[model samples]
Target: MSPTILAAILSVGVSAIATEVDSPQTQASIAVPANPDNETFAPLTPIAQIPDNSGDSSDKILEQINHYSNEPNALDQVTNVSQLRDVSPGDWAYEALRSLVERYGCIAGYPDGTYRGNRAMTRYEFAAGLNACLQQIERLIAGTNGVDGGDLETLQRLIQEFEAELATLGARVDNLEGRVAFLEDNQFSTTTKLSGEVIFGLAGVAAGEDVNGDDIDNVTIFGHRTRLELNTSFTGEDVLRTRLQAEGLGSLTEQTITPEGDLFFAGATDSDVVVDALLYDFPLGENTRVVLDANAGASDDFASTVNPFLDGDGGSGALSRFGTRHSIYYYLDGAGIGINHAFGDKLELSAGYLASEAADPGDDTGIFNGPYGALAQILFKPSDRLNIGLTYIHAYNRDTDTGSQLSNFRSFTEDAIGNAVPTSSNSYGVELSWQLSDRFALGGWVGYTQTTTLSTLGGQIDRGDLDIWNWAVSLAFPDLGKEGNVAGILVGMEPKVTDSSVNIPGIDTEDEDTSLHIEAFYQYQLTDNIAITPGIIWLTAPDHDNDNEDIVIGAIRTTFSF
Candidate 1:
């Protein structure tokens, strides 16, 4: 029993002992986010974490390992033989078990609630128990207090009987120890992990026409967006992230006179990889977090958009840019800093400022003078499934980030109200998300921005304000067809100039009508690391003008993550 059980336990258990002794930790399973900011349904967790090397390995492994058998599976440690219900005074090995329990304080390796002396124990199981007893006895010999002579004699006899088995176990453990040390010495980074996502899309303008009656091109294009993230946690609680991205997906909005059909993942890097995002987030106290973005930071990085299921981040959520989050969030981007403070479980506040030219050193082009957005928001959560956010943004010289060029600035308002003239806007938005049930959710947002032309072209025009409005409603079905599937429908109005005081072509403004945007997408998680989404977007008007023909954009996207 001892020879077989002890060998099996020690052999397989040595690797565990080596791991424990070296204290090389495996990371806790915190699903690595496809977009690290998001913790919910992030993606396949494959990155290995190097744990904090601390604590005693031998003590931990020794307590659980058995000799040659693996079957003495127990969780609780028994200090007294009586704690093991199967053992009685009439048992033949009762005195030996009592001696190990009370004298040397060994035998804590017993499985939970049993002492099955009648059963045949495997080598793995014996080695596990033997490992614990050996460690306890070793300590006794090293201490000056000395062990009891009678118990020592009994231990000596047992040692003599298992001397050959013990020698083999020692050699195996030593070899494992060397292997563990080698791994510890060669690991790449103890503080950093790499996770990435790659996306391939086949997209095209399926239908449309310009206001001038020109037919839209129906050419299909294949493109890709790839991102690799370097996530570093300096203090375990704080994270420093750097994202490198290469995106070639063209905006389908380019197919029409309006930008309403632009894909959320669409971007032009000219196919060259660039540093897409860099930020460091650390906790200030128990409920406050501070983030410093050196480049390409968006408002969603800090403020609560309140639309969890649709904050696309390019790959995980919706398909169109307008479908991702409130248009107000698009105003806050570039380099910036932000802070989030929670008042309690039900309420929170966030504030941040970003500058498009924060790095420019020239006069009138630096952080304070360049295009920038300052934002403040209040988030309310009445329950685990509902979130509401009220947001306000103040900006100078920045256009609406996800709208038509006409909506970006009052069209024909002399230099487009953006290029030659400085523009100032105050935007307000309200966003709400409610998970109605495990399978269904509702979310939406309404945003309004009032902009005043700064230049007025040297008194040629009045510095009147323009009113722009946009809103959308979404219905989300989670696990629609499969466990990891999601189907979503979005219906909304694109940003349109409802009332413009800025003069354009002999009138205050001719901006009229509303452009309706309807979109639907179903993301099917093909595997832990892959998702395929097919979606379509319909635009009712080319730039809030019914004179233009309606347009449709179609796409099939595939995403891979690790």
Candidate 2:
């Protein structure tokens, strides 16, 4: 008989004998040996006191069992009883354990060859051990080898009991496979994403006069603009962005001769699609990144403008161009390269160069020889609520007008001789914004430009050198009417000809006055991806002389984005 069977029979007999001796009804029928030492039988410990041998201690053994179970045909190389460190001749269950290891080939020991036998066993450990033994029994049965009939019957019963649970697990796995297949079939491009936006604007003007001093009869107009962007990434870290845009919006500056700067989204006069911008940016290291603009716009390659409340593209914040950022940002408008380096999250430096005629290769019009604008800015975020930027721009033969009323002053100086003369200028500006609280924010900017005409239009006609100054303060209330809503008011001087010395021979020409530009706007987010903004711009003294009627430009803008 196997040692396991022997131990089981002996254990059952001892328990019965002990129970009978302790029973009140049968105690008198039992007798104690006169001299216990003289008996040949060995004393047996209680079954509860016999150490449990299958729980955490069997973890290493279970791992090997799982491996062999997964590959049932794998060869079992362990064959000797002495291979295990803890299994020895003196062990009470050594014979049974050895038989299981050497004959059935189901048992495994720890990496160090130790067989821990005193640890408690859990039900899962018992199941794993039984499964290994069953596989060995099945091999013997299939080969018509010496396999016990009772062992085969027990294995068959256990398999039948677990049939329902096994079926449920298989069903769950099949469901997961279906879900994965569906996702793989319906997914979009792996490396590219698309986004788009459309804007509709209704605008009108009132109480504005022309340069001829006649009351300007401005008509109300409606316009629309649309944009679609595709963002592609190859390395997962770098991005290539391409944008397509179409617009039928008339120039906001076209209604008035005074050069009240253009709207932020006003450009195309026809509803023709064009490539608005294309840019590629990649990281150089942890803190630096380089940007290449195939067709860059003014704001494409700059760091934070420090005025988040009024910087959206006429969809959020203020609707006018001047209200978005300082005019110096408008100096660049074409292809360029930019570099930005961050000093932690609180500070950053950005620099870039852009040429208006970058694609042209004619005499004075190429990327290198054409009218080019170079900009450098240092941005600081002292706190989560405060941002500041110090900017400097140097442009050669570039137009300094940005549709704001101040642009009129700059344009007037350039057109002094009945022809526009190219000018070179160095502009310096400081912008700051502070979110004082959850509901309110304050922002402002001060800009100065020193311009020198480059044309040799003779002595008296030469406009010589000019100095322009512009500044504004803005007050904004976030979530004013509802969540995702904003209201803002801006008041500042338009670029003014603070000092100009045009040597017109006998006539001394200079602008001695500055105009005030006041604007107010409210943006209401109608949905997660849609917004409506109504705004009004009031220019006091459209001309430095204050002779022109106060200009009021009002517009209602609607935007949809996805």
Candidate 3:
């Protein structure tokens, strides 16, 4: 009846309006170059310019046809196609009927193109259209429920499963959002201090065995101890300050490894890794601040020749088992740079890079090797009373090539085992500290390492693999006396966790055992620019058989700061 209904009834309205009405040539003929970037490309041809007739139809049918006509391709109905035979209105009718034939295959074309539109009274053609409609209706009915009549049921089920999974994922995201909000609402802050002590001591002992049935006077030169440490900060920003110290440098040969063992040094020897000072900070929005003295020239652990690694309290005043720390070297020289920053005080971050040069070893050049190293650290203070920090260090030493000159220090009979063993190594450390009050504090540390070679032979031979581990704990008590006096005690033990052996045949690869460390200290003000410090330490490590092995030393030190 109407143009729109006629097209849909034949199903030709959908296809002809889409392709024939939206022609590129028609649009280009009326085009102005206004919105070129988003313009759609379409086929350009004179046949695509046909106009649609404005006729009446059922409102639904008319609306659908107009919508299809506005799409990309619509107007290229009859003239847009190329054919061997001439096409007329009858050809358009035949092509419209072909859409149903292609999908359902229910009808066959006549032997000649006559009576196709006007005389379609044949039962066979009518039956074919009925068959096509019945087939499409049956397929639609089967697809109405959860399943399909064809094998496409599997595809439908898969789509449903995907939708369920998407809903579950959305629920999980909502739960995580609630948890994150709760954590951000309850965040708090913590503060902590970073401090440590390194002591080096030297004292005389005898050749006979002590009451403990161990060697008393195998007297040897040793680095009684060394310590590096930092002060704690918890203020929601980056802050860095450090005080490094080394003591007991002048008195090296003072302890016995065995009863009659030869002396490690004829007398006092040189110290290698001395103390240096670095102070750095970041003031709110200001740049990082640093105050370092390559040569502070103070005295004692912080200075040179005037104050050695030891503090002169060696004999009867040695520290008990309750107050000792690991040993370190004094008179040693090194230079370093430090950085400190804080992201709001709870997460404190600090790092340092240090390099220590070789000190001139006196007569026994082989014993005093050249060592270089780097150090870095990060600390976290989540509350005002507790602090945690981690430290990383790397060190390297050149092979001491002149072994013959230091024969008196340590003796070795090479079952071909002794030689120059240059090594490079890294150490990692973690510390936890707590301040109980203004007058008391406690802390501990654990560190592991696969360090440089602990030499056996002279500087000529090397045994590459030597691993080590270190650990400790300590407590400090302050304000024991008047305003100027202070006291503290510390005790810790570090046991070796490695089979202390090198690749050598017929040589006894002694099990590297753990060493026990202890220290005690008391400080009194002597003057405005000076303080007197008396301290003692005891160190013990077992032999390969787990026997008692120990060394005891003491010292007195004076410090000045400006």
Candidate 4:
């Protein structure tokens, strides 16, 4: 008979197509990047996640072919599924499908030879394939001496048998095509995905003392921080992230004269928007990923902070910055580059360098001449439930951004020794996380830094050394009250000067005695796009000095994400 009718009549056509066609891919779904430390916030939920395909599917003969193809992901969709001889049925189906593809150009699989992996095959796709076959046959019929009587009869019979299905499929195809067109015309940007977060907090000092030995005022204030991120991917594997941030949340530590209670969500920008982060990230080879920072890029952007569940880039994680991870990480900030390489699944190495004045070209204001931090970390995952990391940072004039002034004042001993002497430090840290169960997790870190006076302006004080230390442990309860809720408790010591040969002239000379930090927070996810957290932080000795009055802070924060 006719070539068109003959192909379908053969046992190969319906069965082979069903069995060989890779799962029809979904043109409907869009990809969202990763977590807060990566790109978008709120792990894979509604606005922060890819949408689901709404296509109707079934196990009918044609659908069976699609089922096999859908297993491979978008990245694997381009893989060539050429003539595979290892499986006899696969080999036969490949040859048969290839013939129909070349002869009629029907169901043109993929240009790269992979069947339309996971891209759903709609009635439109089927009708297009069918039309190609019918059109080719029509051209042949119009040719001289095209078909014999037997062939003509066979084709007519087959057409009469499937006429109803053909018409229905054609009408459905037209409708679907129109809908797809309208969506394409109305959808958001083809290359970029948008995500955003807004946090409103009512925070204040419940009790405390100022460093000047004055009773701290119990002032309460309401503030906010907002972030909007546009993540664009030129290539499937790389992403360029641009973030807009605005914050006016004031810190409770300002009233206590200690940095221990600095709220993670607080930033005193007075509601002024800024391009807070601009980073371009791409895969280097197979295992390495490189991050280029054009603006505010922190070490955790690429490097593993090793604190899971509680490492939400200060937006969704701990209430205080010190509870997020080891305070040593505070040194790795500013505009810089970060690189991560995976040795395998179990181990990874991350390194980076950041300079506060990288964008400045004025005298003594260039990258290397300004405050900077160089960091290296090795992370080991012994099991799915356990992770350990060892980190080191060599920095010049880098402050412990989240701790007390003894830790925060790294730029100079100028305030203390009267001379603006430069300082450098070497910081070491160890981090660990263990998942005790699906609901319980424990994480903590310890950091130590040795600071050395680099030079003196007037040689008024002998250049000596200072030793600083900080430690913390956190326990997390996941899905505590609800499926998306978390209850966290953290206890730690803020960065304090344990010893210093070089002395300060006016201040407490050094933070004396041990200061304990106790914090607890419960995050209740009200909806996929919203969460509320009420937390309390208590500092027994503000600024690590026992003489200072104890500080207690409370905050209720609400976050909306999209």
Candidate 5:
């Protein structure tokens, strides 16, 4: 018999008698020899004993092999026995193959759809079939469907073992969701934000020699100031700021000084709330901006003040206004409009007009009627650490005194005979600041003003031209003791009557003496939004006369912000 026919007959016999074995001895009993031609077919020994000469049987086996090889193997692709064209319900392996194909999607059929179960087979064919079945079993074990009772039990056991880890992951996801909801619900406004600050101050002043050389007793006072600001932005490049403030601190008792020694937090002594500032600023182009100030202060529209450490009102700087900036900045204190244009990042031009009574229509009041101050300034920043400003101001009837001894020109010109004087003045100033290191800086400004009396009523009393000058140097230590802390020292002459030729016949019209103002302060940051500052100011020869006793001002201020 041909080897190919013998192999086909043995394959059919093996399939016909195949059984699930539980022991090695049972598997060995049905195992086919590796080479069927050389070794006897052990599994088929009991089934039939082949005759030495059996040509007729060999011819029958060859014909069967040829027929099976030519037929299709429908079980290779069909999902069910009913889809097969030739397999019958009586086939021995029909139920097993159907179960595998339908449950695991492992089977594929030939194009003709016939199950050629009588085909000869090789060991390679057996390996390919086993591989497909094993892969299908793995898919059933991993997924949620088409699993038997044993597989379902195994998946449940795995889920129970990892229950704690799964619960932790779910809880983390829930926490993130809650945080997002809270942020969305509690946000303030889409285009605007509200912020506030409250300052409480304990201040005391020891009066120096009065005008008559009498010693005045020391006075102590407590005061509070609160400010609420709303910052709104329509476009990303513009800002609208509205601020409301209330304060109740009376004026200082000692009044002979030029700047009046007003508390930094002093405002309406009756504790009435007022709109302190209303300003809208928008970009004109890439390098220019226009500012509309319904009510603006002198410091509102200026660039850097040269003395940064002494500029803040109640929080982190000098307690006295005289120590903050040059007296020339005191020329304007009410409503105004301004513009700022930058030439690259190093230079800027700023100009503004402010009228003290811009909102009043009474005599000597109104936007352009009377009592206005106009200013123009050119600010230059040559490097990251240096800044300079050249400023000029034309003021009408605006007080120049800011509680500093050198600012007596304004007091001398206005408070002469207890009547307001119609005066026009022109002021020129130069301010500069240099950062010497990461934590130390030096700043100073020199200002000159020429006042012209315009009232005819003061015919020869105090009418003429007056020349006033003031200069100061400031040293600042930023982050002195810790981050956000500052220490500052100011030494300067307040507005001084440099040369006066007032034609007052019966009164002394010449001012030949100049006084020195020395101030020191340290600010300590208690928290991100809170600070405490302790400051002291000493004036030698106050009121432009060495005969006056030295004046001392001390204050402790606490500020809270949100």
Candidate 6:
């Protein structure tokens, strides 16, 4: 009976944690004029020619005016120009005249069929005309500024004046200059980005037995478990990353129970960390690539509270050789380098090796001597819709880590009876995936593993090996309202069955265990920069006698760009 179980039950009345959300403010309106006093507002119609009209010039002018007026708005009459009647004498017509000239070009008229000198433009009219002028200038600068004799100086001066007015109006267009640069280079360019995800979750056991194989007696809530990562990039082609994770046994209530029956809350410490990356981009052809990577850390596909890879970092699970609970997840941890490459549109290949360390004699480190084993894999994808893969691994168990140590966290340990046992093992597996459409996809993997153990004290033990498999499918909506925003759901599951044997000197037992896991996630985009995601996980482990195994996890996050 672990003491931490009781502590979790006591904290049931505690409040759930809260998350923060950021909302964007709507922009306020600004007032400016499209036509300034200094500009002339005129239609393409030529001066009503007196009898002195020259060479079809009148016809050409009329054609131009009719072409420009063909659209909804036309400058046939001066009233189409913006009005700024509040101009006081000697005031900075710098902004006023700029507005007028922008509206009519040179000369402007009035709505009464004449230019009204004293008619004051209301706030609404002023804002509309000003916005129109700004939009036109922006388009001209974007389209003509790079052409020969495109009046670059005029465009610059106009941009500066508009910017000044915008600033004075308290409408700060933050990073507008950067935006201009980005738009200017919209043709062919590359950008590198660094991003990461943080996950915090809680897990509870409804009914479960202990390591002693006792009848079901306790329900425990475990963890303050969290995962963190740091990512880096060089050019769009290179990437480097690091990750750290931790989980503890204690909380606001109590930690663990004592052999003599004491209550306590034993807080947590460092769980595991990893540092790794590709040395350089491996190019196979124009479009194919292959890369190499090396790293060390601990992780799990779904949950890590029960058995963390670096469990050696603390507590009773700390680095041990024999006695410790052995789970498939824990055995899968180790560092190795791998090769991944895609050729043309048809073939792809990948494979890697992992070396496991030895634990102290008191735990099941699966290590008999030095480094444990190695793994290799290959994958083929003929198209985006289909994929097939295979993997092979050879593992070595040592009797002791006394003579050699290959790497950190992966060495050999002795058994309880001082036996330096060792094991030689091999495993084979296959993988597959299918993207039925842009909105949905499915995937799965399966494998069979076997092991042979030999020891100076226990002779030889042959384990019957086991089989494992995982499957998943997902769907998403396209127009979810932009990036960071997604609508739809994802569902996945894994079913496991293991039939194997262990030969210990005094005890030999056949073990058969099975478990099933189901999970789902839904995401909602609140705005361009904010999103909310909610998910749930359910597990049924007959071997552990757990029921109603449900866990909830979700997050509210906001992102910003510079």
Q: Give the winner by TM-score.
A: 4
Off by over 4 Å in 1: 1-134, 146-186, 211-213, 410-419, 507-510
Model 5 residue 507 distance off true place after TM-score fit, in angstroms: 2.5
User: What's each prediction's clash count?
Assistant: 36, 7, 57, 12, 14, 39
Candidate 6 regions exceeding 4 Å error are: 1-196, 210-230, 233-236, 244-294, 297-334, 356-369, 397-421, 460-502, 505-508, 512-514, 518-541, 544-562
TM-score of 5: 0.67
TM-score for all models, in order of appearance: 0.72, 0.68, 0.41, 0.77, 0.67, 0.44
Clashes of 2: 7
RMSD of each: 12.4, 16.0, 27.6, 10.6, 24.5, 21.6
Off by over 4 Å in 3: 1-249, 257-287, 290-333, 358-371, 398-419, 452-464, 494-497, 505-513, 525-532, 541-550, 556-562
**Candidate 1 lDDT trough over 10 residues, lowest sum:** 27-36
Ranking by lDDT: 1, 4, 2, 5, 3, 6
Across 301-413, the per-residue lDDT of candidate 6 in tens digits comes to 11121212112222111111110111222343444444455555566555444444433344554233445444454556677667666656565652111101110001211
lDDT of 3 by residue, 450-562 (tens): 54455645544345554545555666655557555566665555334354435445544444444455566776656554556666555554221235545555545444433
Q: Which ten residues in a row have the lowest lDDT in candidate 4?
A: 27-36
The Cα local distance difference test for each model comes to 0.71, 0.66, 0.38, 0.69, 0.65, 0.33
Q: How close is candidate 4 to the true structure, as a TM-score?
A: 0.77
Whose lDDT is greatest here?
1
lDDT of 2 by residue, 1-562 (tens): 1223222222322111110111112211101112213222232222224343333333454443333334222122246758866666766555545555555655554445554454343323233334434556666668856666554554454445433323333443466589878877986677898899999988878677754467767788888899999999999899998999999788756667655544677767798999988999899999999888888556545566778899985557777777888877877778888899999989999999988889997898989898888989998989999999999999887755553332333355455545455678899999999999999999999999887877655543665677777899999999997999999999987677677664554533445555678889888999999999988988876755566677788888899999
Better of 1 and 5 by lDDT: 1
Cα lDDT of model 1 by residue, 1-562, tens digit: 3221222222221101110111232201000001213222211111012122124254433433322223324334456868878667754445545554555454433334664444443323333344446676567679986655654564454455444445545655687799978978986678988899999988988888864568987889889999999999999999999999999877765566556778888878488989999999999999999999999999988888888777768787788888988887877779989999999999999999999899999887777888899999999999999999999999987776566555677343434443356688999999999999999999999999998888767666676778888999999999999998999999999787788777644543535777888999999999999999999988887677777888888989899999
Q: Estimate candidate 4's alpha-carbon lDDT, on a 0 to 1 scale.
A: 0.69
The better candidate by lDDT, 4 or 5, is: 4
